[model samples]
Target: MMLHPELLRAARTARRPLGLATVLLAAITLTHLAQAVLLAVVLSRIAHGDTAALAPLLLAVLAVVLIRAALGRAQRLTAVTAGATVRIRLRDTLLARLGGLGPTAITGARAGAVRATLVDGVEGVDAYVSRYLPQALITAAVPPLLLVAVALIEPYAALALGLALVLALFGPRWWDRLLARRGKEHWDSYEALAADYLEALQGMATLRAAGAVGRVRERLEKRSAALHRATVAKLRVSLVDTGLTDLAVQGGTAAAVLVACSSAATGRTAATGTYLLLMLASECFRPIRDLSREWHAGYLGVSAADGIAALRTAEPAVADRGTVDARWDTAPEIRFLNVHFTHPGADRPALDGVTFTAPAGRTTAIVGPSGAGKSTLLSLLLRQRDPYRGRVTVAGTATAAYSLASLRRGIAVVSQETYLFHATIAENLRIARPAATDGQLRAAARSA
Candidate 1:
């Protein structure tokens, strides 16, 4: 599956530290390979009564063991560092994009879906960075080195090992397309379930008041069932892919062993050489198997990346002007000049060529029955939505011309349904003017 170019680049860039880790891991792999070859040499020497090679060969095995442990630790550290960097950058980019888009774009978005993306989706990338990427490199690198080593001892075994690797890597690629399609469906179902459950909980009070809680619960259950089904289907596909990869590895090992044994029988290769080639051939497929397993885990990350990329690509609201002077203390006049607006999917305009003015230092209350576009007018004045036909002006300048921060600085709104924070009364009012003196607060309270 093709990754988004930006995400792929980010993943690649994160691995700069892993360059050294890669070299270290390769050294470890080679050390293990050397140990295997040495074991074969030691066995051959023992048969010839050469007691001198035994002690040094035993010491070499101990050194290889230590190096292998050190290499594992180094690779893990580097992989974690890389994964963390990628996650931070991905999250920052997602948040910046979401912020630029503002609340309107997210108005209809599900809380649970957003939570899943911000939490689970971002976290899921860890496996891809830590396990999948390094393993893929090791799988690609180690197998060839082992093939060369095996070729030196037993060329026939090497040729057989090469074919097995081809089967292991390309065989999964064929299934990857299918797995990716299923994975997308699985993630969609999971997100849908999350959204449904979140919506149910959010409206639980209303549902209970209307005696519809059972119905909502039933709906949630249905979504849960659907999610379960999708998950199981994806799991089944993964099992099939895993089974195929294992089959290839086992079959390849068997073929290599048989070829080596026949070469030894014909005196084309020594028995010790045959054993060495067989051992290295088996080791060669170890990284390949890890890579195949990583491929399965990567499906989740790939799916998440798709969701994140889509969110990042959404067009933001008109670009924000840089911060402007907060001159709203001057109480600038508000005017709407032949403004028009139509809500999406509405047959008629919500505000048709509407024009009004509120003079400075005057209290001009808007009174209209519900659905008379009063709130729409307020929203327009607040620059929550731009007009379709005309413009709103504050102090003779177009509202859009000023930064959003500047436009809202002048207004103090109190709705009939007051939203009180879970704080002291003074704290609630302090939101209006954070640094107001005690006397000023008392005067404002008296005015209220």
Candidate 2:
């Protein structure tokens, strides 16, 4: 699937730290490659009884080890910083999108799916940032360096290494289609199980009282079994990928060993060159292995990305037109002109051409039987949902002309099902009128 431009922008911005990490990683790789060549030279000198070469070779190896260790530390620090920044941006963006959706856009979404997306789905990205991203850099950088080193020692060995890399990268693309399908099924089953579990927990008392706990438990068990099957299917894909990578690594190493041995035995290449070829061949596979392991973890992240993208695509309840006049005090009065609305698939209209007017400083009470569209009227006034046909006006301007936030500021709503925050009563009431004095609060409560 094509990634959204906003998501791509966020991903790119979050990956800034990877640039520095890449440099350090490359330095480490080059130093290690140099150390391998030096070790091969030392071995050849030992065979010829040249002990003088051993001292410098030992020192070079020590220096390479130390540098590689330091580089590893720096890479870790950079990876963590990048992961944290990316995670924060992703979470903030998800929350902002959710906030913009309001109640209407989220009406059809499952709470369990949303919870999974916000909690587990977002957290899954850490693996991508910390493991997959850095490994991708190393795979891109280290492989070519190793191949070059191999080419200098044994050109045939270098050719084998290059083929191994192709098998490691593009070979996996062949299985991606299968993995993606299984991954989607796995995520779906997980979501279904989570939804069922939450529903059972919320209505535990009702289920028990009705003697239907057994049925609920049975259904949950079935969902669990389905999830297990999906998980196994996903694992099968991973095992196939692992097998392919291992085959490439082992086959390439054996080919390099044969080429090096043949060249050295025929006196066409020095012992040092043969040793360097073998070592570099092995080094070439490390990055490939790392990449494969990361791809195994990436399956879930790819699936989670689908969920996040879907959430981000949901349209906001109120559009930001950018020209909304916030000066409501001097604007024309709010008016509803024969507004009509019906929810999708509903048999009848909730508001059938309802007309109403509430001028500034005047209180209007809309009393009706339950299901007589009182709440629907309130929704229209709040601009939670636009009319199917007709227009709402605020201060002689269409409701669409006002900014969502600006239009909302001119009205306050109190419903029967009062939603209290997890705080003291004072705090909950303060949400409506933040600057209200304690005396004013008490008077308002008394009036209520």
Candidate 3:
């Protein structure tokens, strides 16, 4: 049930709310212990036929139960709030990072895989943040407290329960590697399937043209089957771990029960003491049980951690963070001086020692066959990428000197391929200049 470091780091962002939630869980655990003791006393009294003393004790038990219920509800609410805060903040950070990376960094990855990281991957951490993390604190704290209570009553019983707790906690470590490997495999399969489906959707027309739609569908079926197999393998490992945990829990409880019965039979402790030992022994394993359940529910967060880390660490194409003004007095001459660039992981440079100049206020057309570096030159001007060697300058000032926002604000681009949002024609046109008036939009439309 070890949490990934990335998940723990993200939890720090909502420490206050999560702290409150953990406190609530600890309070709830104390209530359960109190309830167990109260029930033991009530049962003992009933055995002694002390009907007259039952009223207040039963009322006290009722009050404790009600308090525990209220605390449980508050803990849930606080945990959910913390999860939401972390998810929103993390998503915002990832979005900013992706924006800085630009197309040059992301274009090499599958579109659906990127979308999964931004949406589903972010959501996957919610259970771990909200439930598992807070409960982990309870699991660590409550069992020791319970053991001390039992030890005060029956030292031998406490020792037996302690050994069981050790086994339950550490025995599962034996298979943790297998579980983690399966979890990663499952996430990889999911990403691959998502990417494949998205690619198929985007290229449906091309598939139909080539009469390969059926073949693509068959491939998607295979991908879906692979995902299913991975999921089953992960679940199989989880179920086995759960079985081992349960065996430890039940075996420890049984051992404690045997010790408690022996102490009572030999007249070492009274009925109340025996009852207390029994209840505390069962209660000792409660936190571990909750931890096991939460581990199953929130394991996806562990699997998604790598994806989140990858996006958070990816380097942006324009790392200079330009500061000089991109707004020139006039359309300044743009010069590419002995520029060289190569795409990531490519064997050869896209532009090798290329040099050119476009005069101010002059229309320049760069002609090239497919795969030539014409578009690469445009990309450099737009700061989508920097040149590997030499510099791209406007009026002798390097483009890297201007802030990204200011530089982009001063440039307007019309791409070779046009894309329109799901909006009216005017709305689509207004995307580039949101404040454009109807007359301006009409003029732009007419000119186009």
Clashing pairs in 3: 322-402, 322-403, 323-401, 323-402, 324-401
The per-candidate count of clashes, in order, stands at 0, 1, 5
Candidate 3 clashes: the total is 5
Q: How big is the positional error of residue 218 in model 3, measured in Å on the Cα after superposition?
A: 1.7
Can you rank all candidates by TM-score, best first? 3, 2, 1
Residue pairs with backbone overlap in model 1: none
The model with the greatest lDDT is 3
> What lDDT score belongs to each candidate, Candidate 1 first?
0.78, 0.78, 0.89
Instruction: Point out the higher-scoring one by TM-score: 1 or 3.
Output: 3
Badly placed stretches (over 4 Å) of model 1 are 1-6, 12-15, 18-24, 46-52, 321-326, 405-448
Provide the lDDT at 30 for model 1: 79
TM-score of 2: 0.88
TM-score per model over all chains: 0.87, 0.88, 0.94
lDDT for model 1: 0.78
Q: What tens-digit string does per-residue lDDT give for candidate 1 at 75-127?
A: 77887787788888878888888866766556666778876776677777766
Residue 302 C-alpha lDDT in model 3: 89
